[model samples]
Target: YRVGKAPVPPRTSVPFDPAIFDATSSTFYSALSNVDFRIGAGNAGAVAVRFRVAQHGYLRHVDFHIGSGLAGVYQAGNEFENLRFFGGRYGIMSEKTSPAWQFTLIDSEFQGQRNAAIREHEVDLTLVNVAIRDTPVGIEIDRGYSDSLWGKDVRFENVSRAGVIVSAENSVFTQIGFDNAVASNTPTFVRFRDSGKTVAGAGPRYRVSDFSYGLKLAGLGTIGDYATDIQMAPLARMPARRTPAIRAMPPVRDWANAHDLGVKGDDTTDDTAALQRAIDTHRVLYLPVGRYRVTDTIKLRPDSVLISLHPSLTHLYLPDETPAYMGVGGPKALLQSAKGGNAVVSGLGLWTGGVNPRATALLWKAGEASMVNDVKIQGGGGTLLTKGSPIGFGDPRARFDGQHPSIWVTDGGGGTFAAIWSPNTLASAGFHVSNTKTPGHVYELSAEHHYRAEIVLDNVENWEFLAPQTEQEVRDGVDAIST
Candidate 1:
């Protein structure tokens, strides 16, 4: 008998029949054909496909099984091997598949395995634009004045700490004004350091417009540390113009013809009393360019006269033969008045032809209200002659016997003398004031002197010896003399 052929089984289960299944089901079968036959399509959807693997091991076939849905419906056998899978790995086939029975391996193990190897990827992107604004704050530029770009004016605040070096070639702060009515107690400008240190580099070159009053560097820091470094031209180029409220005082004439009395130019008559008479008239007494011999001490009373030396080339000589001819005695001569009086003596050269140790060129008695401006007291010959008595009219024994000074004020009260030039050796004190309740109120002494009484020297040049009394000495003297 011929070997009997086993009857051929049906192509596939009912759900997986190629003739009955649409292209979706056909494609799904084709994609899963490589799976083992032991895993049936009945449980295809029930099996789980893990994307993440455990440590030290690749995925094993045993961990994979048929999932539910269409994967579970079809059994895995020879009949299913010829089938195709598409769409979700093994569920359905897409209509887009070709007529050559082509199928998509989408959602399949091979497709996922191919894509899993890729890691780094690239993509394109874009960007956009944006902007911002700012406002200035208010700050004080000087005392009683503040600046704000938004509110008042543009001004830099305390720039000393900002480490900014500001330099203006020709630029300036124009129309900068301030109010003087602000209480004097309030600082006009704060000084970071000592006086004159803040603006030390340049002379007064900077000019402020609309601020007629002078601009003073109010601080004592290095010039570089100033908020601004200004190189100012002369005032003639750009005259300062300020509102009347803050305008500077008018210019004062050094000599006016309206209030002057003429005097002889020869060293013959004692013009001291005559000059004093003219001074008492509240007018200037003019000493023509000549020597006017002084005989007796001439005192200047309060509100009496302002003796003005003519600007012409003339000299008023204090003859060597005479004693102290002009003794400015009275409280007015010392520029001191219990009722607040003022006097000024200006533009005269007070010279003593004799170098008498006893002869003082100008004798200032106690309690005088006087100021000597632009006056020169020179020792003519350098011979120490004894003629005029010591300054204080008290006993001559009371005077210090050492080199008597060219200008001496004794039995003093508060007084002032300014703008005086004395180039002579003072045997005792160049300028002395003693024996008063409040003696030695002199300020701004400029001269070459051996000893200087209590005085504040401002802008003074070439002082050989300035023996200003110490604070303790001043206090002790005040106490001693007041008693």
Candidate 2:
């Protein structure tokens, strides 16, 4: 009998299976009705019926249909839809009819407690699974792992190398002792102690940079009120060698006259041939105190040193109408050997016309080296000119065009220029030391030429111009002096 909100009539019945049907079925049409239902038997025999209700007011899994007399007599399809199960359990029993069966219930609620206990149980199980999955295990240290002490005393070992060790050796300053030394009375091989303030010893100190160059070793260490002791180191033994002091060669006299190489003092004519003769004989040429005029250019050969007998006051004159007094081949003239190095033109008053600025009173070639001292060069109240074409000025056609007087001195290689006295009313560079490829040369304003190559210009000065001035004024002043 089924009993619920949808109650069935008393005699009404329907075939039922506890496993397949529940009390929620509309077996009873009214709440006030009661009905009896029967479940058919299976193949073996009749089975006892069972009904179980859920807390959520629904019928749970229950077994009823088993071996019975009505086996295979009643058949029901498994497919069902829109079945409600919430409440007390209801049972029905009926006999099979016409090999088929139909349900009678429309809608009914089972009588039981309604709660969400099953959902809560599922959530608890999920939490337990998460806890088990999240538990930590072990850790690993990779090759890239680094700690604060990575670069310290400890280091990774490389076994394949020849001189590699797992542990480091002790430092050189480590303590050492005898094998039989007592454990509590170890003795050190070397003794080291810091000196107190009262004790006498040296310490580090700082110095100012401004006085660094003037500072001396004796001034480095000093005691407060007491003097510091300096211990000098022993000198090492060494081989000795003789060294001599160099002295200047004395002046030679009558050396040129003996060789028939001498210039007349009173002769005002251009003595180019005599000068060339003296130069060819490689003798000391002498131009005694006189105003000897030179018309053409005079070139000096190697191994020939020209010397003037007179001192600074004597005068050697060059006519204002003539061309340059002296012109040595630019780079062609060179001092061949150190012994052959001697040329002296001294005690001469040189005069040049300002109109011919390209004319040089004295020109030295690349290999030629000479010294002019204690001589006066006066430009004839005009610009003294100097110019040299390819034939005269080495391989390159060089032109020197300026009002400023130029005395070109060149060593076949290159040399230096030293100015003794700065020109007045104009400034003139002293000497131009040439590079190896070039030669050294010197350009003087108006000056006397004296002394040998060694110690030349040792004590030479120009009376007319004694101060340094600008280049323009130097050119103009040189021109005025030459004129």
Candidate 3:
């Protein structure tokens, strides 16, 4: 067994044997680099090639057969570079520890496998300049693991089903490219679990030529694309808007100074109930100068106005791990109006805890004649002043997860939205509008640098996009916008 970095001998034509190379007590190897264990085609699971990275083990420039032997690369906190994994049913499955095993791959390629290229379970995996092609599924991050998966410059070419299936949280994919392949399933390129909050960045030349859907989100977060060709149909517009009732409301109370209701605008305190109290009692709920923490979703009743008293003095924050909004009785959003109503939300900055991908700043389901004005849902980029102070100015932690959104409007319609700025969200469509009874006017809407397409409108009636700006050209599914 070699301890330190040494020039290892090449096993050019030696058939990989499991009994001799197994890292048991009798036959143990410390490290292996620049070794080639090439095996030809054989039956399924006919041979087994196994290697374990002990305390300080490293594997580099190792070659193996494609879809032949049961090759298990088990390691703990190890580095693998320049490794070529050829065809295999389960090409190089990781038998590492759950939630602790860490592996780094650099300049690696897994090609022509019948089954998955790389299957990992509860491992913190990082891939740099890695390519996986001509396989059924490219990479599968198994479930029941809550760790990180980071990849940079990864390419997937001519895969059958899914390119990548992520079941973990806090995953980041940068500059991923897909060429000349059909991801048959809708959202076939990348599919995430409900808890997966991923940040993906693709260059302008990147294209998913034939995929059912580019990204499918089950949780909250955002997807940002600098400029990529996601060739799919747009989302289908709803037939008609199910408009909600419009109600008149009285004036609101001063939330910060309302000590009796225990509405403290301190960043430390959970002000969800106090703010709800203000909403129920007054027609309008005004926010004062302070950082307010909201843990759960605050469902708005009919006929109310929630506005920031001073833009510089108010910061509404939704912390990490905030449950996503699924349905009527499902997860809650920061500010949601499930039942469409006549409400107004304006003049504030909504920030997230930079964790949960399912956290949405504002979800408005308002009826006709509603208005949302001068609101900024600040994520990774953009500067917001609260109470004469610049909050989250140049703060790198101000980013949003790919599944979270700045604003989502559904069901009801006929609302006017003006001056909404949502930027740098990881992978969400900045302003998503669906199924409105009547179309409304949107002015000065900026949804820039989102991972997915920006400003998605579905089944909207006579809705006008006035001075709407986005970072990339919006691409839709086949039946999305071709009316």
Candidate 4:
């Protein structure tokens, strides 16, 4: 290499090999921008892209197509924007322990195949208008770090498990929406970290529910300050306590129509294919008042408006093994949205034909931007559930054997479940919301004869049960709702 006073031509391309950029390697320095890297799936490196402040390097507009098990490593003072990560285990993984590691992501989208969308370990991070989808977990921050995680206008969609699992202190999350999280073992909007102050908007405020006692007390964290505007909605405004209404069916108007697929809802024939076709084809999928047998689980899309002609007439029948089959070796949801979007499924009677003790009647893995309004979930009231069998504990195989929840809401935040009436005698809890950071409201939820708890909320920061007449039994535990 020769030294020159003339303007040096920039290195237009560079091989993104992990071995060359290891911690022990030379201090690699570059001011590279507008670079496209095709990191092959065969690369078995632990980290995909790592930058060191010692080199004073910055990467921008760098599109990466990484293979499996690789993560985009970042350090402090690095500015990344318009960066797209596809098919990687961890979309963006920052393990910087330095307080000066101020990493910022703007206008980026992380489409991970599995694992966390962004895993930051002891790093001061900020994400503005970033979208993460098709991943299992989103934005996991572990190990106490310097300063809070500042995020605004961020969206997490179609994740399998948790939306944002953080253990960081002083984290600030605002204008964030987590959508379409698939229901799985541990579904949480935010988990682990009990520290940090959160300021949210007014019209949409949160409430704290459920608690833990005994040895878990020491491990329990605080739900920090939530600054909101005045004149918010009342904590408990009871909905109308009348019988289910039969609304007049409206004329077809939405673009996506299910009727074009010949879905005649006769219980004998399998309407799964036709129904699924309609759901895939139209934005607004309509179902007439008829008993439809769905052999397979109907997957929902984003921004889908599924309407039932009448709550009493529009019915969906599930097989003997419902979500129980999900617990077993089969896919169980009668209807589900794996990649959660703003889907509204209204006015339908979902019933299980047989007593498959390990099944789930209705599962919402989609984000909180979805809804299941005016829908009834029922389990076949048989001697099997009433006889009272042994409940399993501490075992994954026996997780839902003798008991199962009628409805399971996971991950998807900002969705509503209004006027949900489930009077069927079930084995487990009536409703279960797990691992959701910001869960939408539930209005007029009526259910009875649950063997276990009525509703179970785990790892939730805030929730509201707006049923004044619908008395609920609170679990006897320590008062764990204080900062």
- Per-residue lDDT value at 413 in model 4: 47
lDDT of 1 by residue, 231-311 (tens): 322232312222211011113443323224544444465566665555455333444455554554445554333343431
Give the Å shift of residue 236 in candidate 3.
Answer: 43
How badly does each model clash, as a count of residue pairs? 52, 84, 52, 30
TM-score of each predicted structure versus truth: 0.35, 0.31, 0.42, 0.41
Where's the lowest-lDDT run of ten residues in candidate 2?
123-132
Query: Can you rank all candidates by TM-score, best first?
Result: 3, 4, 1, 2
Candidate 3: residue 8 lDDT (0-100) = 33
Q: Per-residue CA lDDT of candidate 4, range 44-94, in tens? A: 565556564411234556777777547755443344556788877777766
> Candidate 4 — number of clashing residue pairs?
30
Candidate 2, 1-483: lDDT as tens digits: 233343333231355333333333212111111222234433333313222121011111222222232211111111111122211111121221111111111111111111100111000000000000000100011112211100001011110111011111122211111111011011111111212111111111111111001112445475222222222121132112111111111256534641245554343555555655666775455555554444555555554445544322223333432444224323211112222244444434343333333344444442324445334333221112222111221212222232233343433422222122222121122222222333332322222111111011212222112111122223233332221
Query: How well does model 4 score by local distance difference test?
Result: 0.53
Using lDDT, give the best candidate's number: 3
Better of 1 and 3 by TM-score: 3
**Off by more than 4 A, model 1:** 1-262, 268-270, 281-283, 309-316, 323-341, 365-369, 380-403, 439-441, 449-483
Task: Give the lDDT of residue 308 in candidate 4.
Answer: 73
Q: What's the alpha carbon RMSD for model 3? A: 22.2
Query: Which stretches of model 2 miss by more than 4 angstroms?
Result: 1-250, 257-262, 309-317, 323-349, 353-355, 366-375, 380-405, 410-483
How well does candidate 4 match the true structure in TM-score terms?
A: 0.41
